[model samples]
Target: MRVWPLLPCLSALFSAPVSAEADDASGITVTAPRLERSLEREPAALTRLEGRALAPARSGRNLGEVLEAVPGIAVTNRHNFAQGVRLSSRGFGARSAFGIRGLRLHLDGLPLTLPDGQSQVDTVDLDSVVATEVRRGPASVPYGNAAGGVVDLRTAEGFTGPDGARLALQGGSHGLRKAHLRVADADEAGAWHLAAGDLSQTGHRDQSRVDKRLARFSTTRLLAGGRELRIIAGAMDTPFAEDPGGLTRAQWEADRGAADPDAVTLDAGQRADQQDAGVIWRDPASLPGEIRARLFASRRDFEQQLPFVFPGAENRVGYQRAFHGLRLAYGDDRRWGGVPVTALVGLDADRQADDRVRFVVDEQRRVQEQTVDERQTATAAGLFARAGFGLGAASEVTLGLRLDRLRLAVDDRHAGSVDDSGSRTFTEPSGGLGITRQWGEQTLYANATTAFESPTFVELADPDGGGGMNPDLEPQRAVNREVGARGPLGDAARWELALYSVRVRNELIPFERAGRDFYENAGSTRREGVEAGLDWAPAAGWSLRAALTAADYRFVDFEDREGNDYGGNELPGLARWRGELVARRDLGPGGLALAARYQGRRFADNANEVRVGPRTVADLRAHWRRGGWRLFAAVENVADVDYPANIRVNNDAGYYFEPAPGRALRVGLAIPLR
Candidate 1:
């Protein structure tokens, strides 16, 4: 398939590196800089897994699985291909189904969630990611609301070499198979660059399959007068299996582990397709100050089959979202009256729409139940300012403030459905203050911040009476405080420790009412915890890393209308303690490596009713390099253990979702054409 091409104007912008610093010809220094530099300057409270650490240890399916070892992070795998990971810090508890509360997800600076604040992250394939930056605590103010934290993903810009191509094909147990390929080139002028690739995999579980294809093209141009322009275009198509229900423990034991409890036969399929394009401009000479502007647009369409037993009861749910956003930022660094100060200001606006539909298969596929022909719109406008000052020879203080305005409107029309329309406007104010003290190679820091999250459409939609909607729900809010220290130990080791607490109000809860789950607001709760991690390179070719996170969370002063004191219960899906350990040893000459990893057991539901057992898995990887050619092979799940990564709560009818494949192997190769 032909994907959208990068815009010629943008392709010309990134051809050469542009100085990110501002000019001071006007006797005033403007420290304008690139977004990349801004991110690097910020302190990262969370652990980062990069390079070899990411390649061999990334087992399961999604980005969440790869990050499970991070301190205070838990991943719930609903299926081998679908996963939900949550991150908690110090005493703060994150939603089990979605990782961290007040967490922000970004793709190249663009938010990845629906305007309603819910992320449709299943579309993200791990193989295409270049890097993931995790920011812990409420210090993520610059990204807008939910600054509770942020995960930012960037794709490969393009191959810098003359030309290159790589292809990988493999088959394993459970009818599993996959193929991946990449091709890239840079024009002779070195001003034009292009890259494209595809990834396809047929899964291992019964009736579980996946076929995905993706292509990305980026170009850069060096403009005259010390400016640059860049453009990027990409598209992705993914079709995968879906298992929505779980089995009971009784049935699980009776089945003798031979039958897949999370199995089902359905008539419809599930899929998601997306196309995106973006442009960026950096003008280092405009007004003697560094200035950067970015704009992007993306269209995503998604569909899923309704889980039902009747032959013709299965329905299709789908939506199309178009998102557009723009950002303008300025920064400056200069000494005033013998004191150094750096400041930045930025503004952004984003808009999105959701369209829903249903389908039927009678001899031929056709539109049947238009159960929800709804159009929802959400717009967010925000302004952020941050200033950092040198407190002394070895200490610095940073202060940041952000103001956001969010507006949402929903219009729904289903057959005999109540045609209800409602709109709400919310103004969220959040900020953070931090102090960092550096001594030799050690850095100690303390910070405090506030964050908030608005309710989603799914939370507001009433499942009763033909799926009515709630109009009076309030947004969830949180205040987070944390203190930590990080530094290098000796020449080849690093360690970090953090303690945190969060108080949340108007928490959203899904209640079981008449066999269907509905949404409501829980009174209030408090969460506190500690997280610590260490990475050590004991030898030139060996590395070891470990992390531990523990949290204590409870409902406080919470009362229902009936005055029921349902407090002090362990919040659902909240793990009291979670940890991971990994060790890697490099084998010289052939680029070979051996790896082992272990993770603790985790609860399956918020009520803490069920628990998935702990897991210890091993992996081996070997790579060969000859000139510009490289070949690699990997063996995963060395123990071949069967464990559940996630469980469905509403599946009271007896269905259980098993983990993933066991003892799988793969190999691939890459070659550069010059």
Candidate 2:
């Protein structure tokens, strides 16, 4: 594949020598673990992306632009809004059929991943985010539940920049149109920020269009005695997002922009409206040490029309969902026996309820007869504790443990239908141990961790097409061993490398039956991978960031329902090699950036019969500022490469490919409101 040749270039850059001027990020601290600590002492693989460097000249389209360069992760389904973007870490979330699964997402300390292990990022305001942190592998043991990895986003609190309002307008190819406005101010007592935006587009493929609007508000108050209070609220509305369902390879080869005929015929699409609010309170210096608490709630109204059609089966689904959560924690820093110690204890509780209904659709896509109606509920709680003890001034050891309980239940409400009410309960424990050693400016770390993931309500749906849960579905468990090192290279650059091996039991795998998605357990699976990254400031006004990941994921023991042995087969939908290169340059009042991403070949089925080819895509962005005005432009897919943006794994109907757009252009202007 073409991506192979770039590997040598990346290796040479990582090994190159540099000067002795200290990098600006050498003393950076991370807040991903709810603790403030230097990155050098952290015993895990973590990447922090600064929004200031990423958001200024970008097309405010999706999260892929913000996260694609991070190593050990994959982002796909970029052109489809109805299904949202698919994010996978170390092959953990590769089997997700719809929303995000097997990973935890948080925005401003509030959990975006529901108790049912489903997440949607449509509500996140990318323009307002200030930073993002991603933790890979089993290091996410403290968060509990489907935490194959963790993504945390922190937005601007409106107090840093000048007190002013800015208005932005953008227009581009494919009938794209967008408008955004942001206002912020601060005083001695508090600070406030408000933002609103609207976007509409005519996509590259037939039957693919999207219209969306978003609004957000945030405020912070300075309380007495070193205490603080923060409040946040956001709303999102998508009038319609058409789904141009996956197409067969032959169809794609014939016409890359062709949509699935079934999708067009069935008018497959989705509509969603959501609102969320949250509050956080913190006491930095209390009698019992530092204390923090958070409360959040959200409501969503969603409806969708699928391309699936069957007698006595539903193809139109609608749901009203309510989700809420609360978290509390306490941390203390003390010295015992002349050694420094830091400890934290926390509790997390969350609940989700859905009132769902489904109906059979006619040729015109109108609902005909009701087929299923049910109320689903999921509750999850966890208690966790972590401690770190300083072995010496240059070394530390950390230990963490968490116990979690999850309950899922469904109540059949359909009249004159067979009752399929059922419930499932799971209790699991996760733990991690780690040690870090510092040698001058370099640090070495090793960790062993355990994690468990219970089946979500959607994943537990019976394969027999019933209304209740699957009786045989069980939670998946994983154990990971990892070693890594990170430090400065000649003071002008920073580098990190990690090697990890993971073993999974009862691994969850997805399949399609009669046009509907279902999940089953693989007897065993193994994943081993290496990730490397580099950041260098070669000269003033110039910077480069590069990352590469190579993973080998396979089934150790697995047999299908038809008794087909998948053992020794490579897991589908994940590539063995992925890499990204980004370069940025400053020109006084203007800046420019270029990014190229490469994805290696992968499989579209568990049997490894269908192979997806590799491709490399590049994007260019530039911005110029004068006085109080700024103009920006972006060119996506600069090389006009044709590639499969997403691959639907193990599809029985031979529908697997979703082609990405060739080339697109966008230009925008930002005006300061006096």
Candidate 3:
């Protein structure tokens, strides 16, 4: 509360200041542009967060808790470990109920998102991550199949200076226990790193506990002729992660920690195991250009129980999936017509096959019926090229183009239904143009791009017990335009701000009927938003970070089957305003940190009924270090705010709210060995 006065004074002084020379540090060099370009000059809306900023919220078992304040990004549902984090960038992924959609996730340069535009971040080794980069706005031209956003989680390569190791232990409220170990060394074998960890929590809500274990290994080896090779591998096992489901308004008011009756009755939960490995090869320096190629493969086995049951059908489902992919890229630093140019060309391709089954549960909990037997396959391929050209000294223009083709297929083996097999393919050519001009430490930018997204096979399925795909289902498409400016705010602060709008056609919407969920395409939709972020190091021992967002997402033209003319209404899942602020004060050997977050009230369905959100929560953490050991503690929801944190839109009943956790505490220790 004391930080409020600084805002007015800081603005007034800035608006009425004399001209001065800017002293600013440049942004980091990142691969978010696929060009290994410098963030300060790159003509895109990109942001990067270092690992040191994520340590405070690492034990929450929800990624949203860790990445809460990133600009143009929204991460919520901190208490729902079962369905994973609900993350969105600029309203792109707001409709997702579970897992991640409309975004791409990459770990150690390997794609975690499948070819069908579906992804989950639970397998990421958060304890071992060193950095993360977010690419915002329409991205079809650079990454195929996702129009929302892209997140890249990078891990530590190794220690080039000396050998070191770290051991960490954690204990928290709600029966939380976590431990992690990491080691890095450099010797005659080049450089290598190893990390392993396990964590469990009997969550704040009933029937929502989770147990998970993970391991990661990475190494880089010098090859003959000055070439190099890098390898990365990961393994994960999650024995149990219960799902409490959603609660109605009355139910939420009665008890915020109680599980949904249906979820408790069915014992809803999931278990999963996953493993993946990747290899990267670099060409010799003598080659015409810098050439790098990658190969990767992954396997996942999973099972889950639904909250409801159909008498003759199944409520339990299982999945086994195999995935493989490759990426090849070439970049050249040269001049075209006496102007500096950085041009990159790349190819991406991936294939995935999933085998699924469903089993009925009778009174005795036996497999009474074999209701579903099917295999789904998806393939994607893309070719893209981008070039940046320097215009004069402090201005540049960039252009890029990508051609992508994706195919989805389903092979139904259900004996009770006729052959419901089907296949669909789509090809799209997308591109973007960007311009940036710099004046001292200030940079001005503008971008115009096109985006496309084909529905996942499951989203195209009819909810009326029909096994075949809906013939009328179609892909969603959009165009985005944005402009923004970023620069230093004196020597104590930095700011990045942007405003944009997007127009979309055939926007997908979800609906539930008789316990089955299905999707429909709206005629048109519009989204307009503004995003702002600031990092202020007011003094030597004090640091502050703030972010504010306001967006208006509305349906332009559409009507449901019941002749309901709903032409103008706010989108179901997006809130109009959101804000977050974090501050830290160092006390030599120890530090105190505080964070506050706010979300405005928003609708729970297309009809603008059942509003949720509009809550503010504060969190605090303190830590001290001496020698190679450190101890820390954290308290979340310091004010014990009561609010619905999640909404399951368009449900059969008026059960959309998911209560958030109240006050909780955690304490841990970290020891480093050298």
Find the 10 residues in a row with the least total lDDT in model 2. 1-10
lDDT string, candidate 2, 1-674, tens digits:
12323334433332333334323236678778666677876788888988444547766678877785788989999889988889999888889888688889999889899987888999988877878899999644578988898999887788887689999999998888999899999999989999899999988899889999999999999988889999999999999999998989899988889888878988888999999999999998676679999999999999998866666556788999999999999988899899898888999999999999888897777778987788999999999998889875667898999999999999988884567689999989999998877666677777889988888887898987565689888999999877777888996788898888889999999998877788999999998888999888899989888999988899999998889999999999999999998899989999998989999999999999999989999999899999889999999999999898889888989999989998999999999999
Q: What is the C-alpha lDDT of each candidate?
A: 0.59, 0.86, 0.81
Q: For this target, which candidate reaches the highest lDDT against the unseen true structure?
A: 2
For model 1 the TM-score comes to 0.84
By summed lDDT, which 10 consecutive residues of candidate 1 come out lowest? 24-33
lDDT of each residue in 1-674, candidate 1, tens digit only? 00112122222332323333312111211112122323223333656555555664232246654563577655455344422343444323244223234566776555665456666455454554655666666543677655556666655445443356665454454454555455655553334334444544555544455566666666767777778777877787776644333445665454323334213444334677888888888887876557778898889887765444333433456888888788888877767677777777889788887776655433334545455577888898888888777665555677888888988877766554366466777898888786665545455566677777777655676544433457656777777766666767888887887677777888765544332345566678777777788888998888877878776766665554346565765555455666676666776645555554455554544445566666766667777767766677778677876655454432334343444456778666565544
* Global CA lDDT computed for model 1: 0.59
Candidate 3 vs. true structure, TM-score = 0.94
Q: Which ten residues in a row have the lowest lDDT in candidate 3?
A: 1-10
Measured by TM-score, the strongest candidate is: 2
TM-score of 2: 0.95
